[model samples]
Target: MYNFIENKNTDGVVFFTIPSFEKTKLVKHGFSSKIGGVSKGSYESLNLGFKTNDLKENVENNYKKITKALDLSIQNLVFSDQVHKDHIKIVTKKDCGKGIIKESDIKEIDALITNEKNVALTTVFADCVPIFLLDPVKKVIALAHAGWRGTALKIAKKTVEKMIQVYQTNPKDCLAAIGPSIGRCCYEVDEGVIKEFNKEFTNVDEFVFSKGNGKYMLDLWKANQSTLKEIGLLERNITISNICSMCNSEIFFSYRKDEGITGRMAAIIELE
Candidate 1:
């Protein structure tokens, strides 16, 4: 079973780490929970997205708390604009602090890959899949945000392809984790969405379940796993944290559960 290990720092901030990534000793990474922060209502603490209506100061504080808890640096954090597309960015040390401590040039990008140590790559999410990738041989790390649109667009596969092109990362030597998000149990989609999936993936039956009335339960976790496998990543190297964000709304931020207006949790990673 692919599972995430729960951890809480002395500051009371809670986050999760992928056991497979932890075993590598190549990076510091975690997915944050909405447990400890200063934001109020709806956002109600640990809202990491600056685009949200949550107070900017509160969001910054939340970053500081999460970074400290993850043993990451707030100043080195680089964020993705995440337009829910398949676009990717290659991050370097010079890109550190963008969208956080400094102004950002990253836009229309949903995936970020980096080989630079100490430069953290982050992507925010609310009821969306967060994909964490690592190549131990190349000492590379990447983070991707895969919502329904991104999933259909094959963002996960594209990210891996970019890594292979730029860093010459071999899929066989990589480890990946599908972080928490809205699960098939809660992710109801219409025929239009399913059509997109059918166009990109041939084994839709493995992850898509019809509920009638033009709606279906789509398993993004399984869909992403299929993407990884299609690119030659071993099934044993990929992990899926089957936790549903909407189901565990108390611990996570779920846009659907909160009816669109809610905070965003972050999936952060940095080479140690």
Candidate 2:
């Protein structure tokens, strides 16, 4: 089971933990909620998305706070530019602080994986699902952002595949943690997304349930879990935080619930 930790500054944002990960003590990983930081009004505090209307200075301050909270050096953080595509970038020592220092430095990618020590893999999310991967045997870590589009593109499975191909990791030895995001109870989709799911999954109906009328709810967490299972991870090795970003708006930042104008939480993992 994974333990949840709260940030005193950020009211409702939290991170999850895996006991197996603690055994190595070589990897540091946490999922950030919308708490902690110094953005104001709509962003309040802990707004990580630089592109948001939030002031750059405040976002930088927030980044500093996050690095301090995690006991990591802000200069060593590596982030994804998150294009909502399936591109998975393999990080080396040279890629440290690329995205954070300058947006142009970050290659267009949605997921980041690396075996390098002291380089934290960070991804930002508002309503999208954040998936953390760790190879206890190889000591490699990955952070992935999966929205409906990314899920259909198999981003979670791709991250696992990248870990295997790049670091020679064994899926069975990999531990995965799925973080909070929009849940089925509040994630309603249109026919287009439904059609995409149906094309990929034989039992798509099981993951998508009708609430009433023409509205339908999609379980993105379960969808990503299914992808992980298909990629060869043992069901027991995966820990899922079932919190819903939409329903629990008080705790998490939900783009849907907040109407596209909101701060983003971050999920970070590194090899210590």
The number of the candidate with the highest TM-score is 1
Error of 2 at 71 (Å): 0.5
Give Cα distance to truth, residue 148, candidate 2, Å: 0.3
**Residue 50 CA error for candidate 1 (Å)?**
0.6
Error of 1 at 153 (Å): 1.0
What is the TM-score (0 to 1) of candidate 2? 0.93
> What lDDT would candidate 2 get against the real structure?
0.82
Output candidate 2 Cα RMSD.
2.3
The alpha-carbon RMSD values of the candidates against the true structure, listed in the order shown, are 0.9, 2.3
| Candidate 2 structure quality by residue, lDDT tens digits, 21-70 | 66768887776666766889889778888879999999888888877777
Q: Which 10-residue window in model 1 sums to the lowest lDDT? A: 1-10
Q: TM-scores across all candidates?
A: 0.98, 0.93
Tens digits of per-residue lDDT, candidate 1, 144-249, equal 9999999988899999999999999999999999998999999999999999998998999999999989989999999999999999899999999989999999
**Which residue pairs collide in model 1, if any?**
none
